[model samples]
Target: GLSLEPILLALCEWGQHHADELNEMDRLADCIIRPRQARQPAIA
Candidate 1:
């Protein structure tokens, strides 16, 4: 699972320097974390 704390902190820092680009990067990060699926193995 992705940790939102560090991401949010980094985004805040980036936003201070590059607000527009940070917005786009935030969108991309959202997409990247959405489709992850966990796997389980069957026992015989």
Candidate 2:
């Protein structure tokens, strides 16, 4: 199996440096995902 700690740390550092872009992407992803989530029934 692959070790994820270093990968996640790198990603965190990258995110810190590129938060604005990440936020924009998150907003875009939410726009795309929300509609599908809305159409689906809530299940627990």
Candidate 3:
């Protein structure tokens, strides 16, 4: 429906505006996750 189109577009624009903030959060999350992933012994 047309109603959802505006809402979806607004949400997409908002995400674009906050792209850097989102990427920073992703980097922080990866820092937390990567160490745990690295700790596991390799399955050679």
TM accuracy, model 2: 0.38
Reference-based lDDT, residue 28, model 3: 33
lDDT of 2 by residue, 1-44 (tens): 13555676677666655766656545332211111223667799
TM-score of each: 0.34, 0.38, 0.41
Candidate 2 least-lDDT 10 residues: 28-37
lDDT of each: 0.56, 0.49, 0.51
Please list the residue runs of candidate 2 whose C-alpha ends up more than 4 Å from where it truly belongs after superposition: 20-44
Which pairs of residues collide in candidate 3?
Answer: none
- Candidate 3 lDDT for residue 13: 62
**Ranking of candidates on TM-score, top first:** 3, 2, 1
Which candidate has the top score in TM-score? 3
Q: Name the regions of candidate 1 deviating beyond 4 angstroms.
A: 19-44
Native RMSD of candidate 2 (Å): 10.7
